[model samples]
Target: MNKKPDYLAHAVLLLGMLLFIFPIWVTFAGATQSAGAINRGDISLLPNLSHLGIFVRAFSFGSGLTGSAPVWHMLLVSFGMAMTIAVGKIVISALSAFAIAFFRFPFRMAAFWLIFITLMLPIVVRIIPTYSVMSDLHLINTFPGLTLPLIASATATLLFRQIYLAVPDELVEAAKLDGAGPMRFFWDVLLPVSRANVAALFVIEFVYGWNQYLWPLLITTKGNMDTVVFGIVQMITGDQLIPWNLVMATTILALLPPVIVVVAMQRWFVAGLTEVDK
Candidate 1:
């Protein structure tokens, strides 16, 4: 006989979905309402359509830092930095994973474990040393300083390594037989076969870079180099009393890029994680 589906599980999942979505719904509702309405917290169920001016004011408000701190410029800088980190991380970590996964060499296992050990240490533990190195290199308050320390993560390398391990040995052997060196094999075989994983990593890393506020705020003292998160923070904490409606609107805008990437590339992202599991 066909078994009945789990009604309890379905109910739990439906409840969880509503719980998670409720805050986002509230934020959207608040975005449409006045700051006064949000403060009252009474209009939680429906958006106050009477005050659509909040979004307009948020989008149109010029950055009080300087006339140049436009919303578009903040978006561009944030996207650019995130792209750089994503690309650099994927390339470097993929190469490292390829070398460790396929090669036979002295201390290869040791080196691999060393990379894995880095995963245990939080970035907070390394910040002082990393900052010292960046300062000595005169990269402080610069793009390189912002990115180089965080461009490659051990977790990314580990993820790629697991994905590479799923590739058939015969293909790598065939490449070797053809006298294709490591770089050539990686470029031609591993990368193409693992493109889904790469895409997944890029999306994940891009979101990480985009949401990174503490590190950038700590490193970048200059106003022009500030990222979108930094800009948003400045908006909230600046001399002007933070317009709550505007703050929520800007927060929503800042959130869209990563949300779009995840929604658009969700299939590949899931495929990559599943591949790693195999």
Candidate 2:
């Protein structure tokens, strides 16, 4: 038998990687050029070293003639919202999954299925009713309001449930033998064991919450509450001579934190996704 590598497969993957990296390269190059150079079509694929000030301004102040809050504030709100959503989903989903996985109760399957159904429903589908509920609860312009409605998710719960189910019942038995109650077992054993999974899921859920636009725009009427993702876009959407270089600089700033997070947690994240406890 002859063994040969698929050169075509490698070529295709190489093409895909280039396709992904191309835009990022272009954005970085654009950030270094002046707005006049970009508008005049004098832009080059190679990044110029002359325009570091664009970044400083982008980091130091809000965009333009309007008295919008600073970019730093927008970034702070974005990080705060992302952290809240990631942690919120993990806690709620863990408790819900723990109950569904270990307990024998009436309507247990029904409850699990209900949560699973939420995965089928897109946030846009329920936006109006969700907004109505938020309004009734007077949660608008609040951090909880920005995050809580979006936390109506089932993915993390489902992931946690799978991990819990795969854990040996012997651990529960051992805990019981050791006179550990449910809460104690959870705090002492289950949570510690699930740390990798939680870290993995945090990276994902944080990105999801950070990238949210529509719901945040709808609920956040105040300029100060605008997230970096939305605020940066709002800078260039009008019929004005927008500062393209500054816009690109803000884009780079917006992408950095999440990229840093993914890079930092990559080892644990890969493990969490791949490993199934026995």
Candidate 3:
């Protein structure tokens, strides 16, 4: 017998999608309108194509009156920070998980538990101490200071540990019998098998870094080092009249990188989260 269509499910999904897309559409439309109109709460649902050049202007000079760094520069800083944090977390977490899962060592489980216990400690609890340490190292206002501290993630380590644990013992035995050393096995066997999980984590960690406000706010004292999220806030909180059009345009631009990453890695992300055969 043929299966019936799930109309109710489709309708609910469509409603949810519309709910998400509505605000984004409004923002895009507002970006194409005049600042005064948006300020007067006169945003239109449809964008004015004639005003499309506003994006270029926004990208080149975001709220120029505030002496803010250009949108492009802020975006570049965020992208670099996000990439560094994501890759650093993956590499460090993977090695840590590998050691914990496969190797015999002193206090290995204890070490893993200690790392895992950090998950219970909110980042706020560590900020003052972390800042003091960064200050002592003379790393404040530096790019490394902005990213290095955020790289060690208990969640990523836990996820990686789970993935490593799921690897069949037969595979490890076969690799050993084939004379594959630890590093060789990690590079040749483990890395390839873990590709999907890596992609998923990259997406998560990249977005997390991109949207960071509090830590970047503390670490980056200079305007030039500001992330896009920080720049948006600066634009809004300036002393002069708010430029709603520019703000909306910058918001749209800030959203693109994460969207592109998710779209590009959609297949791998889904596989990593849902695949059972692995």
> Which should have the higher TM-score, number 1 or number 2?
2
- Candidate 1 per-residue C-alpha lDDT over 1-278 given as tens digits, one digit per residue, 9 for 90 to 100: 99999999999999999999887777778788777766676556687788666666665554477643655567777888898999999989998998899888899999999999998898899888888899999998898888888897798898888878888889888988999998898899888888888988989999999988878877878776778788888887767656677777777777788899899999999988787676
**Per-residue CA lDDT of candidate 3, range 1-278, in tens?**
98899999999999999999999999999999999999899988999999999999998866454356899999999999999999999999999999999999999999999999999999999999999999999999899999999999999888888888888999999999999999999999988988998999999999999999999989877878889999999888878899899999999999999999999999998998875335
Tens-digit per-residue lDDT, 1-278, candidate 2: 98799999999999999999898888889999989999898878999887767788888656553657788899999999999988888999999999999899999999999999988887789899989999999999888899888764598898888888877989889999999999998889889888999998999999998998998989987877889988887888856788888888889899998999999999998888777443
lDDT order, best first, reads 3, 2, 1
TM-score per candidate:
0.89, 0.93, 0.96
Cα lDDT, all candidates: 0.82, 0.87, 0.91
Where model 3 places Cα greater than 4 Å from the true spot, the runs are: 63-67, 276-278
Give lDDT for model 1. Answer: 0.82
TM-score of 1: 0.89
Candidate 2: pairs in clash? none
The 10-residue segment of model 3 with minimum total lDDT is 60-69
With candidate 1 superimposed using the best TM-score fit, by how many Å does residue 248's alpha carbon deviate from the native?
0.7
- Give the root-mean-square deviation of each candidate in angstroms: 2.4, 2.2, 1.5
- Candidate 1 residue 21 Cα shift, in angstroms, is 1.7
In Å, residue 187's CA in model 1 sits off its true spot by 1.8
